[model samples]
Target chain A: MDRRDFLKCSLAGCSLFLVGKGLSTPLSSSALAAPPSQLSRVEARYYQKLPDREIKCELCPRFCQLGDKERGFCGVRENQDGKYYTLVYGKVASLNVDPIEKKPFFHFLPGSEAFSLATAGCNLSCKFCQNWEISQMRPEQVRNIHLPPEAVVETAEKYNCPVIAYTYSEPVIFYEFMYDTCLLARRRGIKNVVVSAGYINPEPLADLMKVVEAIKIDLKAFTQDFYTNYVRGELQPVLKTIKQIAKSKTWLEIVYLVIPTLNDNPEDIRKMSRWLKAEIGPDYPIHFSRFHPMYLIKNLPPTPVSTLEKLREIALEEGLHYVYVGNVPGHPGEHTYCPNCGKVIIERYGYTIKKKELSGNKCRYCGQVIPGVWS
Target chain B: MKTSKVVVITARNVFSGQGLPDPRVVLKMFRKGLELLTGASKAEEALAIWFKPEDRVGIKINTIGRRLLSTLPETSITLGLWLGQTICREDNIIIWDRSNEELKDTGYKLSNTPGSLKIFGTDTRGAGYTEEPIVNRNIGSLFSRIQAELIDASISLAILKDHGLAGVTAGLKNYFGAIHNPNKYHDSHCNPYIAELFETDLIRRKHRLTILDALKVQYHRGPSYHPQWAENCKKLIFSTDPVAADAVGWKLIDELRARKGLPSLKEENREPVYLFTAEKLGLGQARLENIEIVEEEV
Candidate 1:
C-alpha cells in the first residue's frame, strides 16, 4: 500500500495485507501492534564512554555527549547507565511499497517497486521537512511496527520488490538498523538503498558504504548560512558525505529541494553543480525537487515552477550530465536525456514511466552508453 | 527600572540520612520561598498573585534524570499540594513531565483522580502533544496538551543542574519537556532556541512562576546524575521572572563547581548564554545587578 493508506490502516487497527506476485497474504496484526512503550535496548555501535556515566555518540556530526538516562539530538539513541543504545533498532515507524521513482532515483531501477521503511527520528531538523510527522518524532511519539532486520528482508521478497529502501526519514540516524538490514537484504539477493540528508560522520559513512547499493542524499543547500538557519546542520559535512559516497562503489544521487527565497538562489545552484562536477564528476543524477509548504516553513508559498526550471537549467549549464526537475508532472525536464546523444532516454510523468528510449543501458537513438544501474 | 526579585530558601536538615527529603521541611521551605518572593506575609497570598481559584495550574517538572537527579517527589509534591490547597483547586493542579515512564522512574505515583492533585505526564492518554506545531522565532514544536490546552497557567518546577550542552538547565530550559522535539533545539548551546521557545505564546503567556529545585544540585557533568559533582545545598529558588530565576541557578552551580575545584561554566565556554538572549527578548533580567536577591532560612 501507499504511505497514506498504510498510515490510515495502522491508525484504524486494520489488518495489513501484503500483496506480491498476484497473491495476497494477511500480515499478522501483532507484528505491527508492538506497544508504543516497547523500545529496543541494542547497544549502539559508534560511541565512546566518558567519565561519570556519560557517553558521546560519534555516529553523526552532532557528537551528542549525553549523560545517564539522556538521549542524543536524534532522539532515537539513548545513553542508559553510561551505555549508548539505539532505541529504534527494530522499531519501524513507517512502512510502504512505493515506486522507486518516488525516491527520485531517476537512473536506478526506473519504474521498479521498492519496499520502503523508516524508523522515527532524524539527525537534521530541517524547517521544511516533508515527513515531519515521523522524522521529527521520537520512537514513542509515533505508532510503530516491530519489523526486525530479517523480517524486513523477508517482507521485501514477499512483496516481489527487488529493492529495499530506507526512506521517508533520515536513514543516517537509524544507521545500526539500516546497516544490519542491508547485510541481511544483500544475503537474500535484495538490493538495499538509503535516502538520507547525509549528515553522518566519516567513520560511519565509510562503514555504511560497504553494505548499501545506492544512496540518495538530500543536499539541503549550497551555503553554510542556509544550512545553519534552515537545516540546523553544517554544509561541509554533507558535502563531505556526497564526495565520499561518489568515490565508493555505491550509486549516489543528490536531491536539492528548491524552497522559495531559501536556498533557491541560481548562483548557489551553479556553485553546487560546479563543486559536484569538480569533485564527483557529472555521472551521478541530481534531482531539483519542488518544495511544498511544510512543517515550520508554511508561511512561504509553494516553490514557483519557474524556480525549479531555472535551477535545473543552471545545473545542466554547469556540466552536470543528468539533471531532472521533480514534483512537477508532465514537465519536459522530468525526462532523462543521454548526455552524449542529447536524446530522451527515459520519459516520465510523475512516478510513472510513460516512454523509455533506452536499449538496456544505452540510448536507443544513438547507442550511446548512459551511466546508471540498469539491471 | 525595577529589579526582578528572586528568593532562595534553605532549610536545615531538609534531607534525612537516607538521602530522601523531608516532606514537611520541603513544604515549609516552599512556603517561605513563595512568601519572600512575593513580599507577602503568607504563602497563600503569594500564590494568589499569580493564580486564581478556578485556574488549572500545571507544574512542569524535569524528570529526565529519573530518581537520581530529577525534581524529587518530596519537593514537587509538597509544592503541588500546597498550590492545590491554596489558590487553585486540588483537582486542577497537574504535576507533569514528558513521559509517564520518567514520572514513575522518578518515584512519582500516577494520580489523575478528580478533586485531588493530578500527577501524570504529557504522554498520558488524552494528554498528548498539540496536533500542529507552535512556531516562534527559531522554535517550532508540538507543545504538550497540558501546557497548551489543559492548563491556564504554568509553573516551571525544574531541577537545577549543570548541562553539558546548555551550561545550566534551570527553570526556562525545563519547559523544553513541554515540547515534542526538544532534541532538535540543542544546537549552539541551546542559546537562542531556549529564549525563543519561552517567547512563544503557549509558554510566555501562561508561565506564571519559576522554581528551581536546588535541594541537591548537579554542579558539573550533568543534566544526568553524577554523584561526584552533586551538592546538597538544601535550597529552593523562586522567582516570577523566569530568566532571573535561571540566572541565579547558574550562579549557584558555579559556586558549587568552584568549591569542588572545577572550572566555572564560563571558563568551560558553556555558560547559559540563553539567559542573556531571554533578557534581550524582554523575558526577564539575566544580570545579577538587575535582580534583587532575597535569601531566607526556613
Candidate 2:
C-alpha cells in the first residue's frame, strides 16, 4: 500500500482485515471496514421474482423492482443473481444498552433499560436524519459487528436488559435480523421494540407486529409535501403503519420532530393531532421532538422550544391525552399528564423517570387507564 | 448554446461464440467515435485535447451483471490500453468498477502490474471509497478513491441496458458504481440525484468521455440478463455530454422495445426523466433534435 492509501485506511478508524473470501483475519483495528462484498446470500422475504432475474421488494411502499446486482433504496438489501438478500442481515452496526424512554416509549417500560441495536440503511432518506452516520450509509461504509440473532439475545440476557430495542437506524431495513432476534428474545422472556420512520408496507409491518412488543414511529410531518421533498417517502404509508400498530396488540407511540418552520406549522400540527385522536385514539402518546440541525438539513436552526410547547398545547387542545415534548431535557412537558385528573401520571426528567404515579396501567391519582404496557 | 454531439459506431458480428469481443473491431469503433466527436484528424489527437500525457485515466465500467451482461472485458481493456498507448502512460490507466469479485465475475483478470493497464475495483486492498460523503445538491455519497483521488481523468465505459426504475442505464449511471451507496439514489426514477451526482466535483470535474457498450443490449427486463430480451446489436455509443449519451441510449432501448412488441419506457412510465432533469441543470442536452447523432459502420 502507498503512503496516501495507508493514511486513508487509517482515517476510517477500526476495521477488520479480509483473510480470504469468507474469513476475516483479526488484526489490530486500523483502517477502513472491509467492503460488505461478503454479503449474505439468504433469500429475502416479502419479495417476488419476476420473469427475468428482477425481483420486486414488497417490504416497503417503494416496491423496488431490483435487477441482479442492484439494491433496494434502503441500501442494505440486494437482488443478487436473481434472488433477493438483505446484506445487513446479522450485521450489527451499532449496539448499546439505554433507557427504554430514550426510544421515547413513554408509555411502555418507563424506567427499564433497552438493549439497543441497529444495522445500516433506512428506506427513507430523511434530510434531518439525526443518525445519518449509520442510517444513510451502506453496510460497507460503516464499521459492523457480526452479531447473530442468538448472540444478540444472549448479549441482552448477559447485560440483564429486559427489552431488545432495534433503534439508532431504521430497523425496517434489517427486517430478517430484527424479526429473528425478536423471536429469539421472545422465547427467552424478553420483549423487542422497534423505533422506525414507519415507512413500511402493510404485510411486513403486520408480520413485524407479531414479533415486536412495541413500536415507536417517527411521523416526520403531517403533510405529503414534506414527505416528498425532505423525507424522500410518502406520508400516507407512515400513517397507515401508525394506524395498523394502533389496531394490533403492539404498544404504539408517535414522535413528530418539529423542524422550525418546515413541519412545525400550527395548523398542520392541529390537523395531525385531530387525525391522531380520531384514527389512533387520544391515548397513544405523541411526542413533539425538538429537531436539531443535522444531516443535510444543517442550514436550518434548531426547533424553538416554544414551537414544541405550542405544538404540544395544540395536540392537548385537540383532545389528545398523551401529548409530550422531547429533546429539551428539563422541559416540564416531558412528563405524562393524567387527562382525567389533570395530574402528572409519570414524571420524567429526560430518559430518567423521577416518579411513576401509576398502578398497573391506571393513573394513581384518577384510576384512569393509560394506554400502554405496564406491570 | 453549443449543441451536444453523440456518435453511434457499430461493428457487425464483433462478438465471437466464445464470448469475447474482437479487440481490433472495438478499437476501430473507439477511434472512429472519438475522431468524429472531436473533429480531430487522428484518434490520438482527439484524446490529447482532453488528457495530458501524465494524467491518470480511470475507465469506469458498469459490471454488476457479471459475465452474461456487463461491459465486455476485451472492449474496455482495448480502450484503456489505447488511452495508455496514445495519451497517458499504461501504468496510469485503471479499468475499474466497484469490487474485485464483481470485476472477476464480469470476466476481468485482476491486474495491478506497473507499466501495464491496471484492472481492479474500488474494493482493492490499497483502494476504497473516500472518507466522507461529498454532498452535492440532492446527492450525498462517498465516492470511490479511484474517482475522488487516484484518477485525474475519467471515461465512463458503461453497458447499455434497460433499467426497471431509471428506464435506461448508460454512461452517466455508470458513475453510480464509483460511489459507495448507489442504492439510495435510485428513488424517483433516479431523477435529480443522477443529475446532481454527476454534478459533484469529484465526477463532474474529472469526467472527460462517455462510452456505452451496446454489443449486446438488454432491451427489456434488464440491467439484468434475460436471454429472450438481450439483443446483439454490436454497437458502441460515444459522447462528451453524459446526458446526451444516455438520451441516445434511451432512444435505442425504446426502438428495440418497439421491435420486440413491448411498450416504450414512456408508456411503461419508467422513462429516464433524469435526462431532462440533467438538461435543466445545464449538464447537457436531453433532446434528440439538439444532439447531432452521427452513425458509422466501422
Model 2's i-RMS, to one decimal, reads: 3.6
User: Over the stretch B52-118, how does candidate 1's per-residue lDDT look in tens digits?
Assistant: 9999999999988888888988988888888888788999999999888889989999999988899
Give the per-residue lDDT of model 1 (tens digit) for A1-375. 765565454434312423332112212221122333599999999999998888989999889988888888898998889999999997887777888999979889899988888888999899899888888888888767667787777667876999999998889888889999999999988998899999999999999989988999999999999998888889999999999999889999999999999889889999999999999999899999898998899889988999999999999999999999999999999999988879888989988999888889999999988888888
DockQ of all models, two decimals each: 0.47, 0.44
Candidate 2's error at B225, in angstroms? 1.1
Which window of 10 residues has the lowest lDDT sum in candidate 2 chain B? B125-134
Poorest lDDT segment (10 consecutive residues) of candidate 2 chain A: A21-30
Give the residue spans of candidate 2 off by over 4 A.
A1-37, B113-115
lDDT per residue (tens digit) for residues B73-179 in model 2: 88998998888888899999999998788899888999999789999988787687666567888887777888888899999999999988888989888888988
Each candidate structure's TM-score, on Cα atoms with residue i matched to residue i, is: 0.94, 0.91
